[model samples]
Target: MFKDLYDVIVVGGGHAGSEAAAAAANLGSKTLLVTMSLQNIAQMSCNPAMGGIAKGQIVREIDALGGYSGIVSDNTAIQFKMLNKSKGPAMWSPRVQSDRMRFAEEWRLMLEGTPNLDFYQEMVKGLIIENGKVLGIRTSLGLEIRSKTVILTNGTFLNGLIHIGEKQFGGGRAGESAAYGITEDLVQAGFEAGRMKTGTPPRVDGRSLDYSKMNEEKGDDVPSKFSYLDSTKPLVHQRSCHMSYTSLEVHNILREGFDRSPMFNGRIKSLGPRYCPSIEDKINRFADKERHQLFVEPEGWKTCEVYVNGFSTSLPEDIQFKALRSVAGFENVKFFRPGYAIEYDYFPPTQLRHTLETKLVEGLYFAGQINGTTGYEEAASQGLMAGINAHLKINEKDPFILKRDEAYIGVLIDDLITKGTEEPYRMFTSRAEYRTLLRQDNADFRLTPMSHAIGLASEKRLRRMEVKKTASAQMVNFFRETSVTHQEANVVLAEKETALITQSDKMFKVFSRPQIDMQDMMKFEKVKEYIATHDLDTEILEQAEVQIKYSGYIDKERNNADKLHRLEDVKIPEDFDYDKIKSLSYEAKEKFKKIRPVTISQASRISGVSPSDISVLLIFMGR
Candidate 1:
């Protein structure tokens, strides 16, 4: 039994669906999360980890927006690492290896505790639509539930087909039944759908691996967490992941099974993620390479299950076993399960607006794999936005849209709805043009206020953000104003092996040098006193250090972002006629009509829309 009419109904319970439900419920909407199995809520369907590269920034942004992903990740993390520490602050990302079971459990608990959310278990076979508008959902048992808006976060489950070598089966994932009907319904309803493929690595028994033959990858000495909140703590005792390699012999063994592979044999036609390719694909594509690296990661703190990273494949099980046995540490590996590739139906993101609402169907939204995004972080971010916007739509409020410079989430959505990815869209540092301003450390500074204004981020969150912001600004000011004597500066500079100044200079100038860092500055009595007197935490100090050190780069990026914001401000009316623009190229016109980008900046980012096309539009608009 379900409510007569719910505010929002979320189909599926993966990262995307979970975030969507949480966001809608937290925003005071009566939301229902319907999944095939409630037990697998927010499952880490691929890797048992969260955040990597630009994905980390997304988790931080989710946390900053009062979403539960970051908090859930921190609560379940068995190991913590801040990746790209050696790189600039802009490149730094926080990552975690999670206890798979706990990650899902924590998410369910968080969702259950939320006030306006309800849960149901069922397969949503079709949408309740009338006159090009979705009203609710129809379950497999012919049960109809009415809702004001429906969010389909059906990740990899729309007519899903799993491929394992020559053997193909209908399934969403390992041991899960495939969902059907919805794709056909939507297709018949005039939405264009395409197939996309993604794969997972095998799970093996950790006891079978030989750690002595591999390199141990430990967590950070002082591990950091994903959540900005004090709700969870950084991991203390941590598990170590081991790294091994695939030798020429291993590749030779794998190549023998290539004929049987779904990928090579043309049994699977859909495109998979190019970056995260299967082992067989990797070895075949890079034949010149003698060996490929493999990460042997533990699945949980207590479980003997291990995940064989970089070994995703859909070769014959015997072939998988034989090839993996030749690796450095997996000489006698025991399989928990073999890896397989799954192909699923996805609607072209071009059919969706910036709010993730379908252009074809009013009050209907799509997120996660349905939108052609690959990673959990990307899906979750989209889900959160979709949920927020869906609720706003029903309540007659302006939709919340993040801009390109403001967040990586903004860049992700903009790229999806604008470019329309053919392959699975993954977030990367290179994707965001204004990454310097979108650093992971300052996500709260960038997004908390906006989320707070929207009534999602709590007053406690706002207060915390305000306090951190004030403290960091004061610390940066101290660095700018305080001068260290040459005797003090040279000692610190000499220790860091940097050129010592002959005279006293502002600490900010000295600290701005690449060789100098916060540790060195903290050695100064004045700096240490300021930090102690202000009762500054690591977060505040780190934020201040980045601001002080990268102020010039930050200012330049902000200036660039501001200049571009003019184009973003130039809003195009919803019914703007692209067909009448005689000077526009055929491809540009087609893209404009399809994507229907709301702003000139969004229009400029469309793949085939050249700068000249933008100039023509600007002139036409009398800019």
Candidate 2:
């Protein structure tokens, strides 16, 4: 029996839904989180890890904007790593191997502790829509729970179907039942829906595997965390993951099951992630390659369960075991469960605005896999933005948006809405041309202030961000103002293979050399004194160093971003008649009418709309 209407009703309890519910509630909205099972809240459905490559930068951005992902990840992490240390700061990303059970536990605790939040364990079947606005949702038990707005982060649950060899069943995940009614109802209501496929690797017993036979992959010597918040703890004791490879014999055995693989056969029609294909797909596509690597990752601190990374397949159980046994370290293997592929329905993201709200249905937003995204980080980031925008829209405030140069979150949303994803959309560094400005190291500098302005980021978070800002400024000033003599600079410069300095130069100038790094600069007495005098933390020092060193590239990107943003500033009336413009290209007119881009910049980014078309529109608009 429900009486009062909730401000926001979040469906499902995966990374996206949890963050969405938390964000709305934290911002003072009365929210409801409805999931089929509360125990599975924030479950690591695939690998027992968070943050990889471009996905890691997204977690940092989510944390900076006052989302719970980073804090929960830090609390449950058994290992921490800073990926790509050899590359530029733009390429550096933070990752953590989490305790699967602990990760979900932390999420439930966070949601229960947050004010203005309530939980309901029920499968949402349909929406209660009146005219074009979402009034509430309908559950399986015929209970109609009313809410002002609803954020659907169902995450591979809507009409879900699982495939393992020839066996098939309806399931949201491995052990959960599939959700019904919603996708059909939405489609009937004029929404376009499509199917996308994703798979998981088998969970094997770690004790059965001989770790001594495999190479060890260790965490960072000095661990770092995702959150800017001081309270988020870093891992003190980290477990080691092992690396093993599939041999020619293993491949030969795996090929035997290719006929039965749902991916290879005509069973699975949906497109799976191109970058994270199954082992069968990999071997089939790259037949000449003799070996493929697999990372043996522990699922928890105490549990013997280990996730077999890079070995995703829907082959028969016996065939999987036989092939896996052929691997060097997996000679004696025991599986907790066989891996399988699942196909789920997802609404084309083109149906939604950049705010993540559906254009056809007011107050109804979509996040996570339901919008065709593939990773935990990507889903969580969408949930964060969707929650923020849902709250703002309900309160009659303008939608909160971040520019492309500001964050990876912005780039993700923009890409999804502008160019609808045919397959599972995963984040990549190459997608963001402005990645130099969207570095993981400076997510807070880019987004926390904006979130704080929206009253979503806590005052404590804002204060913490301010401290880092002030300290970085102080450190940069010290380098910019203090001049180092050639004698002093040459000491570290010679060791770094840099040309010997001829005259005294500012510490900033000395740091600009390709070989000069923070550690190398630390050898100088002036740099040491500056750190001690100012009490600068490593994060602050690093920020100052990167900013000063990459200032040229950063400045150039900012100029380019500014120029593009000018086109973005050119507003286009929603659903404007493109047919009236006779001078426009036929493809541009069709695309413009379909995309309904809010700005000229968005129009320019569309695949069919060329630069010539953009110029025509700009001239028509008298820009």
Q: Which tens-of-lDDT digit does each residue in 392-425 have in candidate 1?
A: 9989999999999999999999899999999999
- Candidate of highest lDDT: 1
Clash count (model 1, backbone only): 0
lDDT of each: 0.93, 0.93
Off by over 4 Å in 1: none
**TM-score of predicted structure 2:** 0.99
Please provide, for model 2 over 301-405, each residue's C-alpha lDDT reduced to its tens digit, 9 standing for 90 to 100. 999999999999889888899999999988889999999999999999989999999999999999999999999999999999999999999899999987788
Report clashes for each candidate as comma-separated counts: 0, 0
Clashes in model 1: which pairs? none
Cα misplacement distance, residue 340 of candidate 1 (Å): 0.5
List per-candidate RMSD values in Å. 1.0, 0.9
